[model samples]
Structure formats: C-alpha cells, structure tokens
Target: MISFSQVTKRYPGAGGGYEALKSATLDIQPGEMVFITGHSGAGKSTLLKLMAAIERPTSGTVLVNHQNVSTLRASALPFVRRNFGLMFQDHKLLYDRSVYQNVVLPLNIIGYNAAEAGKRVRAALDKVGLLAKEKAMPVTLSGGEQQRLAIARAIVHRPSILLADEPTANLDAAYALELGELLRSFNQVGVTVVIATHDEQLQSRLQPRCIALAQGRVTQ
Candidate 1:
C-alpha cells in the first residue's frame, strides 16, 4: 500500500528551488490498479519517485508497505525497494545481454542462487509472453517485446507493488493497448500496479482508479 500526507518534493535551483510535488496526498490500497495522469511537468514522475524512494520529499510523509519512506535509512532502503518493481519509460535493457539475463539481473543483485533464479526468470518471462525469446538479444525484439521484457525483469524479483512511469511513451497505439493489458494481467493476480502515463486513450478505455495532477498538485 502507498500513502502520502501533504508530501512535497523540491529540487534546489540556483535561485531557490522548484517544487515538483506540492503537498500531494493520496492512498493506494494493496492489490489496487491505479493510473496517474498529468501533462508534462505535472509531477507524475516525481510522485512515483517518491513512492519508490528514489527521491526524498522535502516535507510531509510518504508511506509504502507500512514503512515511512521519508525516514527510511539508506541501509534499509534496498529491503524496502525489494517490495517494489519499477518499470522505467526507457526499457534500460543491455543490448549485449540475453532476455533471460536481463530478467535475472535483479535476482542476481540480491544473491539469489542460479537454479532458483532461473525458474523465477522463466515464470516471469512466461507471464509476459517472452518465454520463447529468452535467448534473444534485446535489440532484435520489437518495441512491444522489449517493453514486455522490461516488465519481466521488474517482476522477476516478485515485487508486491509495480510502478510504471510513462511506460507507453513512444509505442504505437496497438502496442500501448497490449502493454496496458499485460500490466492489468499482473494486477489481476494481486500485484498492485500504479502506472503514470499521459495516454488518454488508454486511460479512457481501462478507466481504472485515476489520480490526475496539475502543476504538482492532485486535481482529481
């Protein structure tokens, strides 16, 4: 679960600062699929970053999975982050690595044994419809397939919460729909999915619980 109480994030500037999120507050229940919509610079990415602890808030509290992210120590941050699976707008795949290796990166970082990690990697790839492409290079796959591979990497760690930021940014309409459906499938199985995107058609079609932002504040 995610909760924000008057949370604000500011980046220091030459003059003073710029507030990316201004006292925004909201709650996302466990197992809920939520969409975050806003125009450029509306703070959608900042909101997700706060939830993931990639950026600390300047004021108020950010709570995820019962831990106060605003106060989480660096030593314990990785433990907290393990509960989350984040999908970036850029797929961030290494071209030299195979799909299986890409999916196993997270597990490898956490010291998971090869045998166990392999099974989990296969299962995650299967879930994202990329099991057959395990040996394929990321550069060789289609845009949609690359995104699906990213999703697999995120979930291979078996995260409880999935955060996707502008996931459909450069994809075609049909691929965008396919990606949305793929994310929903994970939600159906109890993974809390929070997607930040500006795709109105995708939003209008699925119409999941949405949080709209304007100038860094929740306007929904």
Candidate 2:
C-alpha cells in the first residue's frame, strides 16, 4: 500500500542544511500493522510526514496506493491525505468542543451531510469507548480517554490507512497496552495501521512488523 524508494528529507539551515531523513526506503502493505520505533530526532515522524505529503521527499519517490505523492501538486495534497488518518502526539483536540463535536470535524471538512455526520460521530465514539461522553468537554477526560478520542477523530472519516506518531507517549503501561489492542482491532478489519513510538512494551504486545530508525536512517 505504501513504498518509499531511496527517499531523503533535508531542512534548510544557516550553515547549509540538516538532513532529517536519510535515504530511507521501506514498504508497508495494505491490511498490515506496523511500528516505527526509534530514539528522539531519529526521523520517525519525518518518515510518516513524507508518506502523508506534509513534507516532500528531497529525492526519490514515495508511493501510496500507487500514487507518487512526492510529485503531487499543492492542490492535490488534500485528495491524497484523505486516504490516511493521522493521530499525532498532541491529539490536537479542541478544548472548547465537546467529544462528539471533535470527532465530526473531519466529516464536516469533507462536507458530509449533518444527518450522516451525526451517525458517524456517535459510532466513532462508541468504537473508542467514549459513547456516553459525547457531550462532555475534552478537558474533563483522562489521558487515555483523550488519546482514544483522538483515535475516534482520526478514523471518523473512514480512512483506509491510519498513521499515529507517539500515540502512547504520555500514558502509563497498561493504558498503552489497551491503546495498542484498540489499534490492532482496527487493523483486524483491514485498515493499514502504522505507528511511530519509543514504546517497546506496547510494540511487543502487538508483535507487528517493526521498522527501526537511527539518526534519520532505517537501521532495520
């Protein structure tokens, strides 16, 4: 479902530039669950960004579902991004919005009808075990609940692929394990799942294909 061919990403700097990702190449097939694990500044997030087109490859190509995202025009990014859901470390939830309101943002962005949006929002929350908390404020939820809410928001659009960066960073071990299981449950139904994290315990539980990184390069 995804392939990277000798891709590199460099950032501009006063001295010249800093390479955030070095000639990294890998493949992630449809319906497969995987983990990208490495230390801080290891380019794990850059790898995900390259796949999502948030950052263009400095060289080579990145293909998602046979689409060469590396060469797509600016206006074409949203179309490609719709195929994947992103759950970042921050969750990015709106503190002012209710749980239900947060999950429905994606649908609203794509112009889904209000009637349909209502159903999807509830369904997504139910999936994340937050059905009863629909009208509750995001600030009232615990750390694990907030992460699950983010997951619901990400998947609310029914995206074919899910990308999460450090999803378990703040949670305790038990909650992290639960989050891993929840992610795998989505994969069980055929959604491609890829997560970047430093959580070895969580990775061990899922036993998914792991791609390790070091200093912006793929080490395994």
Candidate 3:
C-alpha cells in the first residue's frame, strides 16, 4: 500500500540546506505491521511524517495505494490523509473536550453525521477499552487512558492505514505493552500498521518487520 522510491527530504537552512532523509526507499504492503526504529535525529520521525503527508520530500517519490503522494495537490491532500490514521508522541488530546468529542472531531471533519459518528466513536473507544470514559474530560483520565483516547480518535474514521510515532513514550511498561497489543489487533483486522518508536522492549516483543535508521539512512 506504500512505496517510497528513493525519497529524500531536506530542510532549507540559512546557508544552504540540511538533508533529513537521504534517498531512502521502502515498500509496505496492505495488512502488514511494520516498526521503524532509530535513535534521536536518525530520521525515523521524518520517514513517518513523509508517509503521512505532514511533510513533502525534497526528491524522489512516495506512493500510497497507487497514487504518487509527492505530486498530490493541496486540495486533494485531505482526501489522501483521510485514508490513514496517525498517532503522535504526545497524546494531543484536547484537555477541555470530553473523550467522545475528541474522537468525534475527525468524523465531524469528514462530514459524518451525529448518529454515525456516535456509533463509530463508541466502537473505537471500546476497541481501546475506553468506552466507559467517553464522557470524561481528557485531563481527568490517566496517561494510558488518554493515549487510548488518541488511538480511538485516530481509528474512529476507519482509515485503512495507521501510523503511530513514539506512542509509548510517556506510558509505563505495562501500558506500553497494552498499547502494542491494541495496535496489533487493529493490524490483524486489516489496518496496515506502521509504528515509529525508540522503545526496544516493544521491538523485541512484537517482532514486526523492523526498519532501522541512522543519520537519515536506512541501516537495517
């Protein structure tokens, strides 16, 4: 479902520029679960961002579901993005909104009606074991619950692909494992999963097709 053809990304600097990704190429098929691992500044996050269209590459091509995402128009970008769910290092939940509202935001943006949104939100929350916390404010929940809320929000729209970046950074070991299992379950049901993380325990435990990076290059 994803194919990167010699993709390269660079950031313009005051002098010339700095390359964040250097001719990296990879392919991930549908229904596959993959892990991306690297130390800080190793370009792991860049790869994820490129895949999610949060950043465009400086050179080469990125194709998703047969569309060359590198050439997608801004007007069509949202439609492309709607095909994948994304999770960030920080939970990025709204402290003021209820869990239900947080999950509802994505569906609302995509024009889902109240009835359908409510149903999907509940199902996603249930998948993350947070159905009971739907009415609770994000700040009132534990860290694990908040992250689960993020997961619920990401999948509430039923995107075909899921991308998570440092999802377990703030969680305890137990909760991290719980989150990994949760992601795996989603993958099992046919949502292609790609996780960018530095968590070694998760790497050793889940044993997905790991793609390691170092200094903007794939080392593994």
Candidate 4:
C-alpha cells in the first residue's frame, strides 16, 4: 500500500545540509507487518515520518495507496492521513482529556456523530482491553494503560495502515511486550503495521520483516 522510490531527505545545516535518508527505496504491501530498526540518527524515524507525510523527502517519490504524496496539494493532506493510523513515541494523549475523549478525538475531527463516535471509541478501547478505564484521565493511568490508550486512539478511526515510531520507548519490558503483542494482533486482522525502534528485545521477540538502516541508508 506504500512505496518509496529512490527517496532522499535532507535538512539544512550550518555547513551545508544533512541527509536523513539516502536513495532509500522500499515497498510495504497491505496486511503486511514490518519493523524499521536502527540506531539513533539512523533514519528509521525519518522513514516513518516520510510515509505519514509528517516530513517530505528532498528528492524522489513517496506513494501511498497509489497516490504520490510528494505531489499532493496542502489541502489534500487530511485525506491522506485519514487513510492511515499513526502512533508516536510519546503517546501524545491529552492530559486534560479522559481516555474515552482522547480516543474519540479523531472521529470528532472527521465529523462523526456523537453516537458513532461512542461506538468506535468503545470498540477501540475494547481492542486495547481498556474499556473500563475509558472515563479515567490519561494522567491517572499507569504507563502501560496510557500506552494502550494511545493505541486505542490511533486505531479508533480504523485506518488501513498503522505507522508507529518507537512505540515502547519509555515503557518497561513487560509493557513493551504487551504493546508489541497488541500490534501483532492488529496486523493479524489485516491492518498494515510498520514500527520503527532501536529496541533489540522487541526486534528479537516479534521478528517481523525488518528493514535495517545505517547512516541514513538502507543496509538490509
């Protein structure tokens, strides 16, 4: 569902420019689960961001579901993001909002009715096994619960693909394993999953199709 063709991303630096990705070409098919693993500054996160259009490449093309996102107009970005779910390292939940409300945010953004939003929110929470904590605020939850809430929020919209960057970064190993299992379950149900991380324990455990990177280049 996604393809990167000779993509390169460079950022302006004091001396000249820094390249985060160099001539990277890869493809991810629907229902496929994959891992993008590398050390810090190795371009794993850059690849994820590029796929989500959070960052555009300096050169080459990024195509999502056959649409060349690099060429899409600004107004069309919403439509593009609507096709995929994204989970970030920090969870990024609103501390002020209740878990239910946080999960319902995206549905509200797309104008789903209150009744429909509740249905999706509850379903997503159920998927993460957090249905009972729906009314609790994010700050009140434990780290694992908060991360699960974040997963619920991401999948509440039922996007065809899910892109996660360092999803278990700050969590304990147990929580990390829980989250990894949850993601694998999502992929089993046909949601394309791509995760970028430096965690070797996670890498060894899940064993998904791993694309390794080094110094901004794909090494495997």
Candidate 5:
C-alpha cells in the first residue's frame, strides 16, 4: 500500500521554485487497481515517482507498505523500489537487444541465476502474449508489441506493485483496450496496479477507483 500525506514536490528555478505537487495526499491500498487521471503536468507522474522513492518529497510524507520512504536513506531506496514494477509512457526498451534479453535485464541486475532468470523471462513474455517474439529485436515489433514487451520487462521480477505512467498514450484504441485488460488481469491476481492516464475512455471502460488531479492538487 502507498500513502501520501501533505506531499509536495518542487523544482528550484528562477522566480522561486515550481511546485509539481501541492500538498497532495492520497492512498492506494494493496491489491487495488487505481487510476490517477489528470491533464498533462497535473503531477500524475510526480505522484508515481514519490510513491516509488525515485524523487524525495519536498515536504510531508510518503509511505510505502508502512515504511516512511520520505526519510529512507539513498542506500535503502533500491530495496524499496524492488517492490515496484514501473512502466513509462515511452517503451524504454533496448532497441538493440532481443525481447528476451530486455526482460531478462532486471533479473540480471538482481543477480538471478541463468536458469531462474530464463524461466521468469519466458513466463513474463508469455503473460504479455510476446513469447513468440522473444528472439526478435525490439525495432522489429509493432507499437502494441513494443508496449507489451515493456510490460513483460516490468513484471518479470514479480513486483508487488505495478505503476504505469501514460501506458496507452501511443497505442490505438484497440491496443489500448487490450493493454487495459492486461493490467486488470494482473490486479485480479493481487498485484497492486496504479495507472496515470488522461484517457477518460480507458478509465470508463475499466472503472477503477479514480483519483483526479488539477493544478497539482488532488481534486477528487
């Protein structure tokens, strides 16, 4: 579970700092599928970053699974991040690597042995319907396939929470719906799913607990 209490994130610049989030507070419970809906620059991305401890809050607190991430040391951040599976608007795939290689990277980083890593990589690819493309280069896949590959890579480590930022931004309607169903499936099996998107249609179709943001504040 994630909780934010009066959290604010500011970036320093001339004419005072810019606040990306203004005392925003919200809670995402374990195994819940939640959507953060807002226009561009409404702090959806900042909220996700704060939840994952990628960026420290400028004020207030952020708690993940009862740990105060706002005060966690840099060395402890990685351990906290391990519990989260992150997907970005950009596919962020290694174009030069094969799909299998891309998904296996996370396991490799955590020192998973070759046999175990191979099994996980294949399983993740299969879950995203990309098992057959394991040997293909990322550039060879279609846009939808590329996004599926990214999802495979994110879930290969079996993270407790899945956080996606504008995941369907680049996909067509059909593909976007397919991806939404895929994420919902993960939530059904108990992975906490948090998606930040502007697509009202997607939210309407899925009907997850909605959290609306406006001008960096939680408006709903």
Candidate 6:
C-alpha cells in the first residue's frame, strides 16, 4: 500500500520553482488497480516517481508499505525500489539486445543466477504474449509488440507494484485495448497496478479507480 500526504514536488528554476504536485494526498491499497489521469504536465509521472522513490517530495510525506520514502537515505532507495516495476512512457528498451536479454537485465542487476533468470524471463514474456519473440530484436517488433516487451521487462522481477507511465500512448485503439486487458490481468492476480495516462478511452474501458489531476492539483 502507498500513501501521499500533502505531497508537493518542486523543481528549482530561475523564476522561483515549478511545482509538479501541490498538496496531493491519495492512497493506493495493496493489489488495487488505479489510474492517474491528467493532461500533460499534470504531475501524473511525478506521483509515480514519488511512489517508486525516484523522486522525494519537496514537502509532506510519501509512505510505501509503511516506510517513509520521503526521508529514506540514498543507500536505501534501491532496496525500496526493488518492490516496484516501472514502465516508462518511452519503451526504454536496449535496441541491440534480444527481447529475452532485455527482460533478463533486471534479474542480472539483482544477481539472480542464470537458471532462475532464464525461467523468469520466459514466464514474463509468455505473460505478455511475447514468448515467441524472445530471440527477436526490439526494432523488429511492431509497436504493440514493443509495448508488450516493455511490460515483460517490467514484470520479470515479479515486483509487488507496477508503475506504468503512459502505457497506452501512441498505439492504435485495438492495441491499446489489448494492453489495457493485459495490465488488468496482472491486477487480477494481485500485483498493484498504477498507470499514469491521458488515454481516456482506455481508462473508460478498464474503469479502474481514477485519480484525476489538473494544474498539478488532485482535482478529484
């Protein structure tokens, strides 16, 4: 579970600073599928970063599974982040690596043995319907396939929470819907899914608990 209390995130600049989130208070319970919907620069991505401890709140608090991430030491960030799987707006895939290699990277970082890493990589690819593409280069895949590959990479480590930013961006309607269903399936099995997107169609179809933002404020 995660909680944000009066959380504000500011980036310093010449003209005072820019606030990405203003007193944003919300809670995401364990195993819940939640959508953060807002226009560009509405702080959806910032909220996700705060939850994952990639960004600390400029003010207030962020609690992930009861740990105060806002004040956690730099050395402790990796440990906290291990519990999260992140999918960026960009695919962020290594174009030179095979799909299997891409998904296996996280496991490699954590020092998982080859046998275990291989098993997890295959299972994750299968879950995202990309098992057959394991040996394929990222550039060879279609847009939807690339997205699926990203999802596979994110979930390969079996993270407790999946934070996806604009997961359905740029795909066609059919592919977007398919991706939505794929993410929902993960939530069905109890992975906490948090998606930050402006794709209202996908949001409407899935009907997850939506937290809408406007001008960096949690309006709903």
Q: What local distance difference test score does each model get?
A: 0.92, 0.93, 0.91, 0.91, 0.93, 0.93
Minimum summed lDDT over a 10-residue window in model 3 is located at 88-97
Better of 1 and 3 by lDDT: 1
| lDDT, residue 206, candidate 5 | 91
Q: List ranges where model 1 is wrong by over 4 Å.
A: none
Residue 53 local lDDT, model 5: 87
Model 2 off-target regions past 4 Å? none
Displacement of the residue 172 alpha carbon in candidate 6, Å: 0.3
Clashing pairs in 5: none
lDDT string, candidate 2, 1-220, tens digits: 9999999899999787999889999999999998999999999999999988788898989998999988788899888898988998899999999999999999998999999999999999999999999999999999999999999999999999999999999999889888988999999999999999989898778899999999999999
Q: lDDT tens string, model 4, 1-220?
A: 9999999999998777889999999999999999998898999888998998888889999999998989999888788888878898888889998998899999998999999999999999999999998889999998888888989988999999999999988899988998889998988999999999988898888888989999999999
Q: Candidate 3 lDDT, tens digit per residue, 1-220?
A: 9999899999999777888899999999999999988998989889988898888889999998988888999888788888889898887788888899999999999999899989999999998999998899998998888899999999999999999989999999999999899998999899999999999999888889989898999888
* Residue 100 C-alpha lDDT in model 3: 92
Better of 2 and 6 by lDDT: 6
- What number of clashing residue pairs does each candidate have, in the order they appear? 0, 0, 0, 0, 0, 0
Model 2, TM vs. native: 0.97
Query: What overall lDDT, based on C-alpha atoms, would model 2 receive against the true structure?
Result: 0.93
- Judge candidate 3 at residue 150 and give its lDDT: 93
What alpha-carbon RMSD in Å does predicted model 1 have with respect to the real structure?
1.1
Task: Return the lDDT, model 4, position 131.
Answer: 94
